[model samples]
Target: MKRLIARALRRLGWLRYDLLISPVAQHPGKNAVPPGELWLVIDTGVKKWACMSCPGGCGVQIALSLNPDRRPRWSVETDFWGRPTVSPSIHQHRACSCHFWVKKGVIEWCR
Candidate 1:
C-alpha cells in the first residue's frame, strides 16, 4: 500500500525524485551516516529532515523505504502541505497525499 501511494505520487507531477547523493559526503557534520541517496526534497527537507536543518529537531520522520536493517535512509516527501495534509477524513477513512493529487491537482512536490 505504501509503495503504491508512493508511486502514484510520481505518476502525478506532485512528487519527484530530486537527487543523487550520499549523506556521508553530503552531510559530513553529523554521524557518518552510511552512504545512501540524499534527496533535497522541498518541504520534506524541513518536515522530515528538521534534524538536518536547524538545531531545533522539529520535523522528523522515518524513511518509508528501509529494509528493516541498520542501514539508515532518506525520507519520503510527498507534497501535501499548506493545502490538505490529506483529503477530508471521510466515513472514518483517511485520504493521503496520493489521493489528494489524484483528486485535486499537483502540489509540485519540489526539491
Candidate 2:
C-alpha cells in the first residue's frame, strides 16, 4: 500500500519519499522513519539533522547534519504542498556509495 503510493507519486514527478518532522532531541525509535521517507529531527527549535534510508535499497540509514556550524551540511526546503527539496546533493561515502539529488520530491541519480 505505502509502496504503491510512493511509486505513484514518483511517477507523477513527485518525490517517492516524504518528510516527517519531529520536534524532539532523540530519534523516536526504530521504525520511526519509513522507507522512502526522510525524518527531520529539529532540536532546539532549529533544524539539526535529517535521516533517511538509503535509496539504493541497501537498507542503511543515512544521517545528514543540518547544523550550519558543521561542514558538509545540507539544507532542506519545503514546497507549498509540503514536499521537501534537499539542496546540493547527497553522496554516501561509505557502503553503497549512492549519490543523488532530492528536488521537489524527485530523486535524480548521479553517475
Candidate 3:
C-alpha cells in the first residue's frame, strides 16, 4: 500500500530521490527530519551543521559539522535548482555503516 502511494507520488512528480536543502535557524532533532532532504542549520549567517537522514534506510540521522575550524568538517554546494552536493563523501562508522557521496543530489554508494 505504501509502495503504491510512493509510486503514484513519483509518477506525479511529487516524490523525488534527489536531495533538497531546507535551511533552518536551529538544528532540528532526528525525528523531525524527512528522507531525501538535507537540513542546513544557519545561525546568524554561519553554516553550523548539515543534517539529514541516512539514505541507507537504516533510519539513522547523520549530522556533519560545517565549521572549518573543526577537524572533521564538510562543505555543501547547491546548484540553481537547489540540488545539493556534499563534499568529502559521508561514511557512517556506526549503525548501517553506509558510505556514499552526494553529487548533484544523487547518492553514489561506496562499494
Candidate 4:
C-alpha cells in the first residue's frame, strides 16, 4: 500500500515531509537559517549547498559535494521548491515518485 511504501522510504532516510508543528517565526533567531546559500551536511561526506533567490520569480541552485576531497562539486539549477520545505513552491512541483521526499527535503538534478 502507499502508506507502507512511504514508511519504508522514511525508514531508509530517503523520504521527508514536515507539518509546521511550529512556525519558523516562532523560533525567530534560533532556526533563522537564511533561505539562500543554505548548506546542510547531511552525513559524513555528503553535503548539499542550496542557493535560492527571487528576482521576478524564485530560482534555486543546488550543488552536491559527494566526495570529501573534491572542492569543485557538481551542481544543478531549478525553480523553488526544488527541495521539500515547510512551504511548497507554487512553481516547480513534486513528481509522483518523489512526493514524500519533498515534505523532508527533496528536488533538482532531475533525479
Best by TM-score: 3
Off by over 4 Å in 3: 1-17
Across residues 34-73, which tens digit of lDDT does each residue of candidate 1 receive? 2212322233233223111111122222122222243343
Ranking by lDDT: 3, 2, 4, 1
lDDT (Cα, tens digit) per residue for candidate 4, span 24-55: 21112233334422334344433343222221
lDDT of 2 by residue, 1-111 (tens): 554665577679765454433334665355545665677777777887777887887777888888889898999886644456888799987778999998866678998
Q: Model 3 over residues 1-111: C-alpha lDDT tens digits? A: 544565476679976546777788988874658986899899999999999998988888899999999969999987655567899999988789999999867789998
Using Cα atoms with residue i matched to residue i, what is each candidate's TM-score against the true structure?
Answer: 0.18, 0.73, 0.82, 0.20
User: Could you tell me the lDDT of residue 86 within candidate 2?
Assistant: 87
Candidate 4 stretches with Cα past 4 Å from truth are 1-37, 44-58, 64-66, 71-111
How close to the true structure is residue 15 of candidate 3, measured as C-alpha lDDT?
Answer: 61
What would you estimate as the lDDT of candidate 4?
0.33
Candidate numbers sorted by TM-score from highest down: 3, 2, 4, 1
Q: lDDT per model, in order?
A: 0.27, 0.72, 0.83, 0.33
RMSD vs true structure, all candidates: 14.3, 4.5, 5.4, 16.1
Clashing pairs in 2: 15-105
* Model 2 TM-score (2 dp): 0.73
Q: In model 4, how large is the Cα lDDT of residue 67?
A: 44
